[model samples]
Target: MSELDALRERVVALERENDELRTPKRRRIRGRSVIGAVLLVLAVVLAPVAAMGTWARLQLVETESFVATFAPLASDPDVQDFVAEQVSAAIDEQVDVSAVVGEVFDGIRSLGLPPRADTALTLLEGPAADGAISLIDGVVHDVVRSEQFADIWTQSLRFTHDRATAILQNAPGTAVQLSDDGAVTIELGVVIERVKQAMSERGIGLADVIPEIDRSIPIAQADSLALVRTVYQVADIGGFWLPWLVVALVVAGVLLMRDRPRAVLWSSAAIALVFLLLSAGLGIGRGVFLRAVSPEIMSAAAATALFEQLTSLLAGTIAAIALIGVLAAMWAWLAGSSRAAAGFRGLVDSGFSAVRGAAERRGLTTGAFGRGIDRFRGPIFIAAVVVVTVLLIASRPVSFGSVIGAGVGLLVVAVLVELLRRPSEPKEMDVDPSADAATSTAQDPVSAPDAVS
Candidate 1:
């Protein structure tokens, strides 16, 4: 073979070897990219689901949480009005006041009253019934608005919390009953009994005849209760595990990326976006719930109050999570290599240096303590972040206030770290003999050394 052909073959072999070396690396890169993408997408998609599941688990599975959540609804004016209206209507339905008054007029007519008197009695009947109804309504309102009623409301919810859970789980129960049309109503037997006793004390003669009846008020309703029950069941199971799963996926996804800080930044932003979308979905679901429940079943105000009160925990949870995501993204960006991040770090460092210089000029240096802090500032900062994050997550039903407090606390810690860090003093420079002699010669040219040729 010719030398040119041999050289060509050698070059071809080197090129083939280079291609073989690049192929595995390219495949590995592509595989890592695909895995990271899948994990991130899963985390983003399931974040809202995890949040909702946590809410449902807390509100349904934990009786105490459920009671704590709904107990406050007793003080809501809208809810009070709704209860009073339902109880009064229930009483009115049981005892027809107009009919009773008509019967009395009929008895009077049998005693040969004048024709004008009969017409007057007939004209007065409706107003008398209306006046009676107004009186009942007034009593009912007073009962519902009183502190005693609030206590009863709380106690009743606590007592029936288990039953409510059972109902959500599709278990048979009589304490908290579900109507055939998907209306979940609680029997206000205690409230009704109280109302009757109050009326009797007020000398309402009809109160003596008003029989003890089970008057149920619909609190929640849907077109398809079966779907709600199914969702609750699924949420009950997922609530226990989905949140952990989502967190694992997010961590895995971030760790898999070569640029972990940037991955974390994007992941946090995506999670926050998901939370915002979840919030919007809640608003839309509220509208849909209100529309689905007919006016005959529940008033708009009452329904709105119920929905808001019940979902308040969920809303707060979402807000706290979103805040955490935003804070994480902010931290990731601040720690990044971008120009903005570098500029911010520079500005902070300059400020710290200025403060330290001022303090040193005044002879108020941190001394050994500052040096120690400076030596371990990185660990201190990391510990602070970890503590704040753990506290935020460990809080039961995390609130916006808690999240904000944590963020503020972290900021304060960072500021303290910067303030406490003192740079070491610069040492004196050592001069080289040759350079020193050259400088001396340059300063005094007449004393320069002779050149050896």
Candidate 2:
């Protein structure tokens, strides 16, 4: 068993033993442990969810993360496509390419080449329409994908988030305006004007036809404020402390159990359940949010995108926590006293020992340094495993490449650490057969002193 696992098992046993000694079973309140376990279950269930909510709020409410959060959307194909459609529709209103086509047809008909010329021109309308829409699509694409668009996107997000935060605090903000009916809005007038100017600069010739485009999209409505207020209150009071409290409660609950490893497994299972619950809650909350707002207030795509972006990191974190719990439980199970667990451990030890033997035979394991490696092998191995797991989980987003890389790196470290262990030399027998026989004769003389012998 690992030092940590052993220590925990001992602690759990000692704590329970101490409690029992202090109070007789008959004198103790009925079902006290059951009630305590129930509370612990609740803690395991709620803590992770509360932590995820806190993260979502921090990301949404903070200025830097808020801007960074939506910056990538400017580059998203769908988002760019949406922007292009809206801009193209607004610009198409003023350009009237069909009018230009009509004028050309009138001029061509005046040539008097054929009576069916107008009908022929009408046949060209589909191609002309395609060409016009395609041209608008190209111009909009370039504008939306530009660095200028990125800056605008960042600024707009910051303004909107700031406005939302202000409204939450009842403070002043310009970009975030509210209707008399309490519909929240972030005006996109500047963004539309910029796109028009960009299209003109790109020599699309439709700049003159691009009418003034200014618009406001609703982000939230008045009725959702009650829900917002609840979250705001959590951010105000719980903040980062909620996660810590969760840890304390979970630890206390685990210690109350006489089998800490089993408790760990149970807690982990409960945490997974919480993850499922939180995911369901997010879906339900999205519906609630939508129902509370006017459908015309915002684009469905935009609303979904906002909710997704806000929850992405939180979801990833929850997944990581669940993964950690599963790994921890598995590790604890490996240390069980069951026959299968023992066999598995023995196999692992034998594999390690074989590797060590090969290294020693190759002269890689020798001297005081090798001895030092043997002394701290367990701790060093644990530290390396922890470092690798944490780096994969916390430092960067995990990908296939990253997982393979981390696995290879950990294997190399383990091999290198094992290579530094000095193999033990077999001890010679303390007494030869001849010496034992001589010692027996001496013992006969000594036995005479003990009369009964």
Candidate 3:
């Protein structure tokens, strides 16, 4: 009984030791999971911020990109009409055609006209003012719609890019000014000058009396200029580095996970969701912007055109990122050990096998070349994916079309590789009868002795 008790105690001690040994490992695994979860969440949360930052950086830091983005707004009919209306209003306000017409009538009356003639001339004042306003409106519309105006628009944007950057940075700017009310105004004084020139060329004497007008037209407005500035500053500061940081976080998080493929799938899906929300948020923001901008400041159509044009690049970037995330998630799922993934892979393999077999039946075998490719098939496919990924990343201003094109190209390459690969022939096994009999004798010693007898 004493010996049995001692034995039982020994067994208990061993069990306790085993539990102690596993406890630390379990704790470490839990800690890693927690850390990885935190990192993945941070990455998903920062993806939209990184995207916006990249856009802000590109628009503010690269003058050429900024010009390219907004230069086309010049040709938009709504924009042209807006400019025409604003310039015509400015000219009418400054020139005072009614007052000018009245003065002309008064001058004629002062030239010794009879009472009846003076009364008739006074009656013509209203018609004269209306005709002069109509003439100014027509000339302004013509100038705003002309090709010369588009050239001037592009040049003005290029020249004002720096000042625009400064304004967004919360610094003083003259050519492009941000008002206290969050109105972004660009000096249309240049457009006014063009109008004056056009009117003069049309042989209108009143154009000489149109004094140089300095007017600024509101292009965009925000709810709070300070908020806009703050956002701009943050985006500019993080633009170049934030995207890379998000990538690093996501990679680190995936590596730390025990189920790396599942982690990649979840993380990429989360990223896609975030970007989709961002795209939706942009759509919602357009509505809010149109509502907030009063008609007195800018017409709805004009504001809508401006908002869409300015955000087109940002929209494209968001779409591209979301698409990449979706692709990555699909890749992760396909590479996983799940039943669906396995079934899909099997289907693809069988299809490829059938194609290869049909080709071989037609004497299209690649012989040794096909076998060699089969040996390196996995690495070749991985290289193709890597090349497409690199090209997608290196392409400036990545768009949906480019991403889809690269994906299609990769699929084609993968299909070609699969078709080109040929399995090597199996080697025949050499049978050794004596060796097999010796092994059987070792397994059945009794049977071996009976055979010897």
Candidate 4:
């Protein structure tokens, strides 16, 4: 009985040991799982922030490089200081990207138009080809007063295409005018013909007149103000946002077929930004407009009066139209599945049908005359209406009531043009129903295993 009791005690002791070992193993597994989950959560939370930080760093770096490279070309002390401040602010993380850009443009505004006199000339006595003595003067004069003389004199100079283009771009307020002497005009014509012949031999023409920098200077002086102007001009006239705009438009078009809501939002924003940037860049290049809200900064006062006068017209007319186009595109996107498109098509068809019914009911329909009138009358009437409207308004005495009436009339006209006018129907071949589906397939391709039995 004592031996039996000893065996039972031994078995119980072994069972207890086994339980202790199993408990620690289970605890270890639970700890490992908890650690893995924590690591996964950390990666998920930090990855996007890290990526954003990297992107911001890259942009900041690029902006810094540009600043450093173009530091010398800053003419205004205010601009230089502003640039420096922006750089410092960026480094300190005190301002956002948009704020930085605003500051830079504000600096640009500080660099206003060059001073002009009634007639200004800077003489250049330089070496001439073929051992011929040559004299050149960079001239700037008012278009009204000097137009005739400058025009004739320009022909007399027989300036090469390159030279002429250079004069046009750099010499602000320069205009070509007819010479006082008919004899001078004749001689100038002969000289120009000879130059044209020479240029033709060299495979050049008026169309080839691209303004380039004077590359004959020393390398150190290569980055001078003269060279910088060329850079700025090229950057300006090269359709500043053409490539980006096309890319955005294509992307938006592709996205339009899939996620229209997102596409409209993005595309509208991109178009608005591109237009504003291009306009502002052009204005800067041409030294046309500048802004000032502070007494210390008097840039707006010095900008071309002509530009200021035209600003209201430009902003109200052309800019407004572009903005409207963007809004329309966005609104169409908001109505997905081409429902907006169908609505527009129906609207156009309804208008034309109404017009046709009206003509039929009048019993005034003739074959050729009616068809011709139907085709041409709209445009002709529109043109006549526009002219008469303008003349009538202009002829009327100016008053607050007249101006208000004109504004109301104009608004009504615009609304009618947009909503009531019948647009030509688009051919069915223009849109491919399968393209959007194909694009989706391309983006997320079908697997061979999925297709297999």
Candidate 5:
């Protein structure tokens, strides 16, 4: 047999002999315990949610501008076409760009203008104006639904369109269209038609028309600084609770897996605290960046600005968290899996070992990427204590009871995690049956008498 095959065979024989040393039934029981352990984990995860009924609303409860904010994302034609089979499930009232196409036709008819466009306004805006078709629809809805002036506004809408078109036609540099390369075209028709179409379908009417008409409101003014700030604040507030819920859920999952009840309860609480600090740091960083960058612009209405900022920040945060956690977990796995390490070394000819040695020399090596470092544990513990002390000194500015409960709960969890973490199993002996046979022969030095017989 090849050397590799012989080595594998020897390893298997040793393992089987080792198995014989322990009762087979004990291993079988351990295998069964793993399945029971999984179910236990799921139960622990759901427990916190059950206890906090209303408090749990912090997790999935829609944000204040949820519909307005997300409406644009939901109405992408690409997304619509992709889900065409399920399009029937979408309510008709859902204002996709398709829905607004009819409105644009109506607006053209009202203006007594040709339906032909000099150039596509949407094309001019390109991807920048995506999902904003719904924002136009929203303004239309607001104008169309106004209880006091809806009728008057609807009657004047056509006249208002003509006037707005005229105003744009007269404005310098604003009337020229852009080329496919995003260059400005000399043709006024291209620019005018684009603005007319977006406005007409949007149902701008009296309420929304005046602001866009103010020539002083430059294109740059649309940046919406205040909105970014408000979004950051609202997100920060919601963020405070979000981490706690996530932590509780994760702890429950881990404990259920380990089948350690006491550990699960305590660990869940500790996880929540870590989540809080992480969330806060994220929120503060986001809020500061959005606010300090631009203070001059209105950024649209205050709430809209905030919602957009929050959405952008949240997207970035989620992606970062997912990527970093996966990489860290992979590093930890590589550090722990020596068998896998051996296989890797075989293929790479000790390249990884050399790199590790270099890293160790430079003080860049960690015992294991995630194992030894109390990253979440130490930072969270210190932060929690500081937050509590600050809150207490401020005459209980916040709910001390909740904070204390959460902190204590997390401490208990950290302790439980340390306790439940399984130690490395003792390595099996690399025994060969041949070796045993040879040893037996040597012990019976008087085997010469048996040979003579």
Candidate 6:
């Protein structure tokens, strides 16, 4: 056993020696460079992702956009109904109508003047309960429709948008607030307090419960409270620097590569993959988020609509990033050895040449104008692509349709420009009469020297 252990140790030592002898001194440095290059590529790829996340958070938290996002909800029956239900539930928790009705029935039993009193109380129970429900619902409806309610809704939605998950994190204060650890909650308090006042005026006894209730409902939360903190941490940390750091790493990697174009192609492909993951991850997250908050608590449709709207910017940014990466990789590949890219380039060049030849035949290529057109044809086509891309980006929503439309539109513009750019050139064709006559005479037997002799 001792001999075997010694043999194993000697073998390990020999392998170590062999590795050092086989490896160049610079090999370690090369490995480090490769690792650094990879890290840089990741940084570059992640820059856009971080940018997307930051933009999403800003849209969700910013006042104007947040208001605009939910303003339409005021008119949406489904959304209004959802809000009414939440407020109604809150009121229910504060005012126990069932207990109130039970007490009235017990009082009739204590009176015991007649069996009719007990029976009368029994009949009143249903209508009384219905009347109470309708009154509270009316109060809620009035609150939901009022200008005051809209103001409250906007503030509450904005607050919830920013900090709904945080209180679940035990961050302090009510579930909804303007800032972390702030005591002031942007709850349905205004709406609820108003409803309580109205209900009190109607001689209902639930005004006291309204002030005592301080728990504001959250629009979003996670399974574990810790996860809610994790979200805030990630959003805060990744907000500005994560993407920039990624961009720096990618730039470093590309700069370090022996062949930059290939590096760009690979890096772009990697970026596309990352954005693809981001896009898919967003989808998966939507499901996870939906699972955490139930339809029983909030309307599933409204929740879905809200989630979709909030993440729309992120989705668009991801798609745009993916598209740009794909286009860059395609260009790099074309600049290298892709058959399709070569064919595309060939087709464009051939079109330009054909157009120039046709113009020349028509005497339109007789001057510097035509020469200039030929010289600038490539730039003109590229310029058209740039213009079209700008237009696509300027569009309100850059959908797949817009991308396809831009591609087709740019292709058409390039073809038309190549064909029609030099139409104003003169059509004069110059012919050499002396060469024509010499060629004709040489072909004639009578004009040939041997034939003449």
Q: Which predicted model would earn the best TM-score? A: 3
Off by over 4 Å in 2: 1-40, 85-142, 145-147, 166-186, 199-214, 220-230, 236-239, 276-310, 357-453
Candidate structures ordered by lDDT, highest first: 3, 1, 6, 2, 5, 4
How would you order the candidates by TM-score, starting with the best?
A: 3, 1, 2, 6, 4, 5
lDDT of 1: 0.80
Estimated TM-score for each candidate: 0.77, 0.61, 0.80, 0.26, 0.25, 0.59
Comparing 1 and 3 by lDDT, which wins?
A: 3
Give the worst 10-residue stretch by lDDT in candidate 1. 444-453
For residues 1-453, could you state the per-residue lDDT of candidate 5 as single tens digits?
A: 864454455556666777788756542445544654454444444333322322212212333233233334223333222222122112122334443554554564566544455234334343423445545434433432333222332223333333323332344544533222221111122222333344566564322322222111111121243443344345445444444454444434443443343333334343344434555665676566456443443222332344344345343333333332333244334434358856763655355445555665777644443333333545654465445434432331123344445446545654543332322336899889977764454444456235224
Candidate with the greatest lDDT versus the true structure: 3
Candidate number with the higher TM-score (1 or 2): 1
TM-score of 3: 0.80
How high is the CA lDDT of each candidate model?
0.80, 0.65, 0.82, 0.37, 0.39, 0.66
What residue pairs clash in candidate 4, if any at all?
147-177, 148-177, 148-178, 150-177, 151-176, 151-177, 152-177
Runs in model 3 deviating more than 4 A are 1-38, 114-116, 164-184, 220-237, 428-453
lDDT per residue for candidate 2 within 1-453, as digits (tens), equals 864454455556666778889887664543645665875787886666566656755654667766776677777766666666666666666567767656666787778766576677778766876786677678777887788877887787787777667766667545554344555554556667886687677776655666676666554555666567566667755655565566666667766765666776777677766766776787888877656542453456755666677567666666655555555566557766668888998997789888877766877656888878878887887688667766754443333455456657766876777666775667886788865754454444444234222
- The CA lDDT at 77 in model 1 is 94
Give lDDT tens digits, candidate 6, residues 212-241: 555565543345545545655566566545
How would you encode candidate 1's per-residue C-alpha lDDT over 1-453 as one tens digit per residue?
Answer: 964454455556666887888787543466776698789889989988888888888876888898888889899998899888888888887888777777777898888888999898889878988888788789899999999889888887776666656777767545656544666555688898888888888998767766787877656556776776776678778887787788778878976787777888998999898898889998999999889764766788988988899999999999988988899899999989999999999998998999989988999888899999999998898798767755655565678999899889989998988887887878889999977854554444333333100
